[model samples]
Target: MSETSWITTPVTADILRGALELERTEHGVLPHRLPAWARAQSPDGQLAMAEAQPSGVRLVFRTRATAVELDTLRTRPAYPGIPPRADGVYDLLVDGRLFGRATGTGGNVLVLDTAAGTAETRPGPVGTVRFGGLPARVKDVEIWLPYNEITELVALRSNAPVESVPPGDRRVWVHHGSSISHGSNAASATTTWPALAASLGGAELVNLGLGGSALLDQFTARTIRGTAADLISLELGINLVNSDVMRLRAFTPAVHGFLDTIREGHPTTPLLVVSPLLCPIHEDTPGPGAADLSTGTLQFRATGDPAERAAGKLTLRVIRAELARIVEQRAADDPNLHHLDGRVLYGDADFAELPLPDGLHPDAATHERIGERFAKLAFGAGGPFAPR
Candidate 1:
């Protein structure tokens, strides 16, 4: 067959899943986890960039194509002091199983020249991600893009015809949390804790794991409420405590409002509240976490004083106790709500075994361990997230 006979399909929102909005770029569509209205309300560049990168977005469709190609412009950010991050990974799943994988190459580069205290952003070459030798029979296919990279999908080409995959009965799990919930130090987009747990639990995942931005905000809860989900999980407290963004008095009310908004939309959805994982630095101390750049390596430091605990300051210990108390009190009226201490998954002993490399995010191994532990604890038999 000639090239003229090939079929090319525009990757539109209809065939996309796990993203709230798809904005058209010069080359392609940029997927945003947060909708337009939400983005407009906040002008924070960090949040905008984080949400624009589709961490949980994937291409869902049905086709008999033996070969497939996706054209995209990926933004690769370079940190001056440290090595350049790895290229984003693309995982292909055929009939709900891992079939093959591909790596995207060459796009835009956002250079953070920390040594010179300068930054630069510029246009980059487009790259093609290709996969071949798929089964000849009609089957379900999922292409999971890298969670960290900002990707603008230009087009999708396949040898065989393709159509949007219809939503099945797979339970949709919408999870909201911190960088830990996001792919922070995870191996890949598909292997994030929530992704791994969803796989083990046999549920479809809609991850809202925004890095450095999982505050118990009204918009986040409103996002969760507006979306359709069977199960909901909120991994809270880390960002709040580390940013030292709130005190005890305000923290309690914020938590309630966040949950109330979500409940307004999904009053009966099984909701799970997870407290912070064990972090020795902030376990006792407070934070307005400062960066330790002395060794030419990026590290975090706790800048908050410990004695402030008496002033109603927030700490991991304080947050956990408050979360447990809040959930216990609410559960009496709402039996579906449950709380889990994140320490059980990554407690003091586990931290001693697998220490955090950044003094913040978990290493890849820990992500897997946490995923497995969560799968068994929450999705296991008689667990709160167990299928009905």
Candidate 2:
């Protein structure tokens, strides 16, 4: 904790990775998951706020320090008439392995009240998260911020000087999906399913999983198209179904267009089209998903009529069937394209083991299951992500 040997370095966006944008603030840098152009297209304040909050973003550098400290300003949620949400967790990784974890004691906390359906920002004292004791050899360190909180990077101090770490030889996997993929209810930033799968598959990650905003927007596709990635995977269908954004008539073409946009930049990149996982609530039923609060807890439920599927209303089952057919038809011309039924990742069997606690989002245990399953199926031998 002594400052005699410590070096106080500015935690600028230069050392940040996995973020699309770093918005400079008077206090410090705010890592944004989405680019500015994408933000400009949407006027919704909620989506705007979520995109700016760092989820997959992390601080990566080479250092010999056994002790490290980072000051941050975090905003958390407080659901009215229900238990408050858990504070964000910070994870520290060294040499590509998890080394330490810490939670902030104080920070600028924002109370997002669900009953009022509004967010209120409250200014608070900045908090310091510190870690001490490590092997003294030079190694890479990553400080992963929480997935569901707005965090501002204030400062980084270490007992020894640090330098930028060179990129690894592994391929980078860029995945796009909805809140589930955005690490909703995930235990920590690095433990999210995508992160776990990346670690297991020996790949770098750039997660574009925007919570509640993965509406197959053209801007997101453009963002992905602009990124340099060795592989690409689109976890489609869930967001489409739940949002009730489009019918089967529009869905097929939308999927094709989205893929077409990505392929414009990465023609031969392995593209895996993932369908929706089994959620009995929306398996056969159409959705305009609704939140149930009769029990004083937030539980999601499908509000759409099941009979509408005959009229092209999309449901999980309907979308899965359509996506499978689309992939099969497209793969004839594009051999690298593939489709995966998300049920294999979290099917009826998984539900029996660990059910979605919120009736929509997966719990922490389910995240682990999905991550491990994805690594085996997506990156294993004969898999699209497998090393050639």
Candidate 3:
């Protein structure tokens, strides 16, 4: 078919799901997990990059076109010594089922040097991903963007006119966490732990998993508070410890304040507080995690001494204990509030069976396990998010 024969549709907000805001950039429309106000408050580069990655964001519409093509400008990050990372994958879903997957040919590259604290962007051309041979009848279609790459929608074309679909009756689940929840090491966008769990639990996902930036920021908490959600979950501890942003004394009150702000907007919504998963490197040792490129492969290691606990340096174990205590104390008057130890999702037994590939993030298989466990624990019988 000729390119001119295809119907070109503007990528508007009506066909978008899971993004909190859409930015009209010079290149195209960029989806953002955090709203403009929140992004403005904290200009941290890591948070900006993560929120722009669109872990659970997707384009959803109803159409009868057998072929579709999407033009995108993707920005993938690169490091100094390590090999180039694989191109991000885009998943196509038809009638709520995975139909196919594709990768864009070329785009921009962002070279990040954490050791030197520098970043450089190299411009490139736009790339197109084409999907064809779909059933001709009317069906709901979703194009899930890559969870790990920054992407801007340049154009969307189809053989038939596409119309926006109405938001269904699924419960909206708002989730906040670190890179693991942001789809690190996950095979695709829809397979992220939160995304997989949302699918299994029959919930609409609004993923706010900002990698390396879940440091109990007030702006992030405020964003979550303002967003409408039927169920809310906050995954705390990993980022705080790895960043070594605060001590135990400050963390306790910060947690209280974050939750308090959310309660202002959602007085009785089911709120679940999740502590950090078991990371042996930071389980008992304090962080300021450091990169280990010793063996020509990227890995993480805790730098703070274990003896620093006496000085209030936080660790995964300490954070988990404190979080459980805080949740227990708060749940007395707030019946809708609950707590879950993330170890229950990926613990010692799990680690032994499926070790974290990078000594930090879970591998793709582990994501599947965590997603299954979360769906069963949070959405199953007698669970906090269980239907009333």
Candidate 4:
């Protein structure tokens, strides 16, 4: 098709969903999971990179166009010696059904070295991903962006004019967690555990799954507090253990403060506190997780001695117990609050059957399993998020 034959539409906030803020850049609009105020408080590189990836962000519009194309500039992270990661995928949904998938050709690369704690960006040209041959009818079309890569929406072109779709009445689910909830190793944006659960449970998802940065930060709590959500979930423990940023002494009060802040805005909202999924490396061991690159593949191992727990070092086991206790104590008067053991979603048995490929992060199949289990446990009848 000729370039001039397509109708170019501006990517505006009204047609976008799932992002906390929209950033206008020189290239185009960038979706940010963290608000500007939150990002400014902590200049941590890891948090900045993770928030820019747009795990659950997507474009929702109503159109009769059979052919659609999206122009985007993506920045994918690459390690020094390890193999380059796969290009991010763009998923097309027609009337809420997965219709097609495509990947951009080229854009930019951020070469990062965790050992050295350094990163360098190499610029490249924008790439176009096209989807053709849609059924001829006015329908709600959603383009789910890559959950892992930093993407800037440059231009959107369709054969026919696209109109913004009004928000639906689905319950809004606001979720915050580590890389697992951030869609790590998931196949695509819509296939992430949270996304899958939202689909099955009939809810709208606002994913606050920032990789390596879910450290019970106050800014994060404030952001979640301000967002409008019918259901709220905070996945804790793994990131705390992996980062070794706190001891048992600090973790206890931090959890309370985080929850306290959220409750200020959502006093009666259905809030569920979830601990880490079963990770043997950090189950009883503390972290400052070490990356094992000796085998030519990326793997993580806990470095802190298990004995340190006696001295107040935090571990997955310790955090889970503390979280349950805190929630139980708070639930006495807060009937709307609840707690769920993450192991219920992915426990030891599940781990033996489907081992984490990298000693962390669930594979695509496990993402599905966790999603289904979450839907059943949290959104099922008598569950925390079950229909009122």
What would the C-alpha RMSD of candidate 4 be, to one decimal place? 1.1
> CA lDDT of each candidate?
0.87, 0.86, 0.94, 0.94
What does candidate 3's lDDT look like per residue over 122-145, in tens digits?
A: 999999999999998899999999
- Residues 26-115 of candidate 1 have per-residue lDDT tens digits of 898999898888878777655666777677789999988888899999987777657667778898899989898889988988786644
Which residue segments of model 4 deviate by more than 4 Å? 1-4
Q: Score candidate 1 by lDDT.
A: 0.87
Residue 45 lDDT in candidate 2: 66
Error of 3 at 135 (Å): 0.7
Model 2, 87: alpha-carbon shift in Å? 1.0
Candidate 3: clashing pairs of residues: none
Tell me each candidate's TM-score: 0.95, 0.95, 0.98, 0.99
Worst 10 residues of 1 by lDDT: 1-10
**Pairs in clash, predicted candidate 2:** none
Task: State which candidate, 2 or 4, has the greater lDDT.
Answer: 4
Please state the error at residue 108 of candidate 4 in Å: 0.9
Sorted on lDDT, highest at the top, how do the candidates line up? 4, 3, 1, 2
lDDT: the better of candidates 1 and 3 = 3
